[model samples]
Every structure is written in structure tokens, then in C-alpha cells.
Target: VAGQFGKSAVAAAPTLLTKELTFNFQQKRSIQLAMVELEDMPVRSEAEELVFSLLIAILPERLPEQTQLLSNYPNPFNPETWIPFELSQDSKVSVTIYNVAGTPVRNISVGYLQAGSYVSQLKSVYWDGKSDTGERVSSGTYFYQIRAGDYTETRKMVILK
Candidate 1:
């Protein structure tokens, strides 16, 4: 899938008839892709300068300044949702879900996590609309509180039937 210099060059390489991917070349092909031709070679640069430029170009988003709780997805969810947040530093984390009457329903203890992001669904805390006793919760308003070491914050969400 590699593209040419600023231009898209599309051609199929030799592949087997099966669904599995292949990297080895076979001599049974009739057509072939263009061969790579280089007119100039790479010039050597300072290691620090190359590293700094690469970092600056690739790292556009920095770490969070302060640890805090972020909003959960699909506020009025049916069966499941994810809670996303970022941490300023390493600390133990926990998420507790409470009902409208302030009674705790679920508790998720996320041991020690490093300082970074838990914002993506794959890395964030997940709730399956179940209580700590492993029973599904009813449709209603719910509050979630996050405790990360010395930092604490709370947010609200809703569950739908």
C-alpha cells in the first residue's frame, strides 16, 4: 500500500488465490509492479536534530496537565458504555457508579496506572450496566465518581432500558 512520491501508484503484486496474506514472490505472475529507482541518496544529519524534528512533527498532543474525570460515552446507553479520562501522573484509580439516591451500584478498581491517556475506548474503563453483585441495573440516572490518588472527580450518566 505504499504510495509514490506525492502520487498514488496502484498495481497488484503477485499473490496467491487463498485469503491469507503472502510476502514471498512466485514466478507464475504475468505482470509486475514498477521497480524502485532512486536518483539521490539520503544525506547524514545530526542525531539530536533528527530526533528533535521527528518528535516535534509526530507529537502534537502532549500529556494532560491535571488528573480529572472525563465524560462517558453514550450517556443514555442501553447496556454498556465506556468512561474516558487522562492522568497527569501515575496513581491508583477506581470508578464507582451510584444511583440517583446516592447508593453505590458498581465499583471498578483499576490498580496502579501510568500517567497518560485512558481516553480511547480500548484503554478506558468499561461498564456493562451491571452492579458489583453482577446484576444488571435499571434504566435511570446514575452518577460516576473517579478517585485517582489525591485527585477526585464526579460525572453523571444515564442508562436506558
Candidate 2:
């Protein structure tokens, strides 16, 4: 089978196996058979090199080490403040601001973002200290929650009207 396929196809087959195959007995047998067939082929340095390159290209890219929610600047803000966060990979992000009584005042949906650091300034993700209906909130403590993929975090802020 290895001899019948081109070098690129043969090289990519192993990568596909690891990604799509379960580690069950049948899968194991298939892997072993593939390895045996690969070994039986005549030694060709160029083919080996192509396989090596293909394997490297087929590997998945590295994800972020961790997701983080940084403290918002100007904690005791007047009408607005910047909320910052970092993501290791693409994710759907939602930010919600709740009053001290736990009532949701503002909900900001950031949609999908790629892996990187994002600030309210650069990304325009800031909350204008207003309710969803565009009314300014009263002065007091409030909670801001950030939900990104599997990560969830809540932080406190104050509004000094």
C-alpha cells in the first residue's frame, strides 16, 4: 500500500491516523500494519525527508498557555473603563456587567477572537457604565464577568457618579 501511494500521501497517512483514530485494538493493529508496510519499503533519503517535512507541517499549532482576565483600569471609574483579557486561542467571548444587587446591567458580546492579548482600548471592548438600554448606572459597586471558552471570571468595580 505504501508503495502504491505517492510520497506525500504516504507521509500524511500517519498524521491522519494519530488525529482521527482511537487507541482501540483495531486502530492499534492498523497502525502496526502501516508501520510494517512503511519499513518494508526500500531506503530512499528523499522520500524520508519528504515524510519528515510533511509530519512537521501536519502537526497542530501551539495553543495559549492560559486564559487570563486582567484588572480593569480606573477601577473606580466615572462613566467608562477599559476591560482587558488575554486568550491563548480562538474563543467566543462575552462580558456582562451586573449591579451590586446582581442584576445584569450591560451585556457585551465580543464574538470570536484569535489567540492574543486584547484590551478594551485596542479592541473597543470597554463598558460605558451604562445599562443595555443606554441608561447610566448609579454610583456603587458592580461585578463584571468574563466568559471565554471554558474559562469564566468575575471581578468587582466601582462607579463614582
Candidate 3:
């Protein structure tokens, strides 16, 4: 509270009147803490500083890491197949199954997933040789792709009748 900006630092922060205590990085090179309370409530100064510093320090490591999608198991699958992959960091990901002709068939995941290796079994939703609409058809080769953050990989499989 007593460095580059001078004692008037507290007065300059009109909008920060709501900052449980404001640290103005733009106005000064050093840090200063003011007792100005946002509401009539109280705050634990040490706890707030600890939390803020920890978050600021970890910012560089928060990005999702790279990953690889492994090939599906039982290449000539009939009723089901297991797809596996690995991620080096936490990420939002999705595994999509596609027919031989390149049509999205099913979503193996519904939301974000954690980092690490994973394997998911996809049931043959319509291997009656048809798609979701309920018509009979033929199949030879199909594919599935796993997308994690900015990384994406597609692997092929054979579906035989």
C-alpha cells in the first residue's frame, strides 16, 4: 500500500471500491493492498492472496496436452468394437464412429473427459447393415476418430457380414 503509486492509490481506484481489496497492476509496479471492503462483509486477507497467487502461477500449465488415438480392437468386428486412446493432459474430448462411407454414426462420449488412456466399446447400433434410420445395407470398412482439444486422429476398421 505504499510504493510507486503513493498514498493516493486508494483514491484513484473508484471502481475498485468493490474489490475486497484491490491490487492495481496498471498503476504501479509494486503490489499494494487497501482495506476497502466491497460489501459490509469481512474477508480473510491471507486466504484471498494465497488463492489469487496460486491461480496466477498456474496459468501457464492449464492448456490441454497432446494425444493419440489408437486403432479399434477386433478389426473385423461383428457386434462391437473397443476404441482406445491416450491424452497427456486434461481435455474436452469426443469419440465418433463413422461408417465406411464417412457418415457420423454415434457419439461415444457425451461431454468433457479427463486426461489418461481410455478405451470405450461401441455397440453395433445398426450393423443390421443399416444406419440410424432403419434400412438394410452393406458394409466393408468403417472408421472412428477421437478428438481431444486440438488433437485429432482417425483409424479404420473392417466390418464384415
Predictions: Cα RMSD each: 12.6, 12.3, 15.0
Per-model TM-score versus the true fold: 0.66, 0.59, 0.48
TM-score attained by model 1 = 0.66
Which should have the higher TM-score, number 1 or number 2?
1
Per-residue lDDT of model 3, residues 1-161, tens digit only: 34544424433443344335443433221121121121122655654644444333322122113477777677777655677776666667777768777888766553576554564554211223344565433557777787778888888877766
Off by over 4 Å in 2: 1-64
Clashing pairs counted in every model: 0, 0, 0
Give the per-residue lDDT of model 2 (tens digit) for 13-40.
Answer: 7677757644553444444444445445
Alpha-carbon local distance difference test for all models? 0.72, 0.75, 0.54
On lDDT, the candidate that comes out on top is 2
Specify the poorest-scoring 10-residue window by lDDT in model 2: 55-64
Name the 10 consecutive residues with the lowest summed lDDT in model 1. 30-39
* Model 1 stretches astray by more than 4 angstroms: 1-54
Pairs of residues at least 3 apart in sequence or in different chains that clash in candidate 2: none
